[model samples]
Target: MRITRVLGATALLFALAVPPAVADSAPSPSASGDDAAPTTAGTSFRTAAEVEQGQQATASASTGDYLYWSFPADAGQRPTVRATVKLPDAHAAQSWQIDVYDGLRRRQACQYGAQTRTAAQGAASVDLSCTLRTVRSWSEPWANDPLPGTYYVRLTALNVATADLGQPISASVRVGSKDVGGSAAVDGSLAEPLVPGIAVTSKSGEDDGDAAKSAVLAGLEPEDGWASGWWSDRWVWTAVGGVLAALAGVGGYALTRGSGRPGRVPPGA
Candidate 1:
């Protein structure tokens, strides 16, 4: 089947109506919140080798950190494909695209629509010393095709101006049921969480001191929503206490002034 670019763009915009972004080095998500290491870092996977060969499409744009995606294991059943993209220090991507492929190597799903597209592939795109902006997470649906088999999800970055696919990253999924034009089924595959790990890179140079300080500073800094939430709570309690103290003061003054006053002090006695 000839896939029209217009249809693909339409689908992409529909999916990107709600863009999803998340930071790299975040813990993998599971129903239980546990994480498992990715089978292959920064690459696509498939149940069978033949399937992998078909989805090897590349793009021009690269991601700042990393991208995450998932799909249902059953065919014909709707699959929720969640993805995240982190931006450089102050620079953000103009738009992005997430593509889902069925067993036949056809573009089954897509999510795009960002303004800024980065030229670098990984951490280099952003100055890690400062705050990191990211698209958290969003979902898209897929159809049951190729008779309910394995599929892949490719999250591609696009230049908002030129409408070009930059660098594409992808992951694999299995489809179980036989549904089409609809959603995935219960037999769809779910991923295991990633095992936690840390990367220890050395810093030593004329700028080593600055890099070291920056690393330390980043750790001390709060996340995007952390400080706002904390300060809001603090101010709320402070206001409540102020109101209570004012009420207490008024009560105390009234009691003190009336302590020894005669109740029947008349004017014309």
Candidate 2:
């Protein structure tokens, strides 16, 4: 009887201890658009600059026009970027595209859905979603790897089918990062920044010898920090250890208190 009671208590304790740890270890669900707010109204990449995670940028452009925005991401972080384009009702149908490029200006593959809208549709806006999993800063010299740096999102109007070349379409872009899990570098430092393509170009009429060298030096400087993976997370391991210790303690106690032990009898009986 005593052994059974002790075992039951141990089991209850274990049950109580595991849930919180699991909850802590699990990644939070992706956020909806409720918190997204437009932080920039600029239409060009250089003017828009870099946007922090969760902030949105609003821009107006026409067909064949490109709108650019940048987001800072760390290694091991999976960033989900979304863009919503509002079309003018005058057009019967339109298509829009979103492309993601790393800091080096190399285009990164993104899973996105093209938006096509018809005049009959009541909804004036269409959404485009792209997810880039696990940002890596390095690979073989010949390999193209998705690096952790400023990821640029380019929104373009593919087909407007309208006579008005100046028709304006509004776009809202948001970036969200979820820590999938990975260990940081041993030194806890970020990899080299990828140099922008135009960093070394001088004015049309002038030539500058230091442009290339300066750009290279700037790329070596760390722009963004590192993100830790699951292995580097100590709290999760500690929680796991606690659960194991509890289970082991219960097992050991059960073994010490033999299953065949006789039950205690009342003195009156």
Candidate 3:
């Protein structure tokens, strides 16, 4: 009976340990699932259609027209952009390409996949894809490394016959991302992703000059001198100015305060 009791106890402990093991082994879901599929694409970054990682964006555009789509990418994610263009009927051989650009409008190099493809004469469609490098949690501002931000996919026909320039063509694009796990994490993180849709509210009743960040972000940032044009210095200067102003007011009050105390009349009142 003792042996059976010990065996049951062992089984219970094993069951208790199984949850963390299962959770650790499960693959993380793609980060771009918050948005829906885009029915049409944008002509530029400002108007780019927004879509999630798995959602597909389709647009009815001309062969030579530029199609643009945007999606959010987080740190440690390796994003791959895939595009398909349906060639117009009875058109000559045409070439198409897919390009990815970061939020700064800088073009990103593809780590793999066919970024450009040419369709044969009378071909129905052409496929193009670009797999980008993993997004970094932090990096130097001068470096062109991929950081957490909004990414854009641009599709265009490289070469098309004059007759096919305005020909009706169908275009589709999808961005998919893979989580690279904690190994890709860095010591620092971006203050915010480079998505244009994000906005911070300004503090009310504060000076327009750097006062917006003087209290909050500046407090958290390092005070030691670093580089010029750094916003942190603005906070430091504002704080010093405020302290000096307060000291001046206090000194003026002390000097101007009458020597006689209130309600204390001297000699004959």
Q: Worst ten-residue run, lDDT, model 1? A: 192-201
Tens digit of per-residue lDDT, candidate 1, span 175-243: 112112111122332231110110111233244655544432112111121111112223444565565
Candidate number achieving the greatest TM-score relative to the actual structure: 3
User: Which residue pairs collide in model 3, if any?
Assistant: none
Give the higher-TM-score candidate: 2 or 3: 3
Comparison by lDDT, 1 against 3, better one: 3
Instruction: List TM-score per model, in order.
Output: 0.29, 0.60, 0.63
TM-score for candidate 1, please give it: 0.29
For 52-101, candidate 2 gives per-residue lDDT tens digits of 67666666676457777776776656677888878767655556677787
Output candidate 3 Cα RMSD: 22.2
RMSD in Å for model 2: 8.7
Note the clash tally of each candidate: 37, 4, 0
- Cα lDDT of all candidates, in order? 0.32, 0.59, 0.69
Candidate 3, residue 86: Cα displacement in angstroms equals 1.1
Q: Model 1 segments beyond 4 Å from truth? A: 1-41, 44-72, 110-146, 160-269
Predicted structure with the largest lDDT when compared to the true one: 3
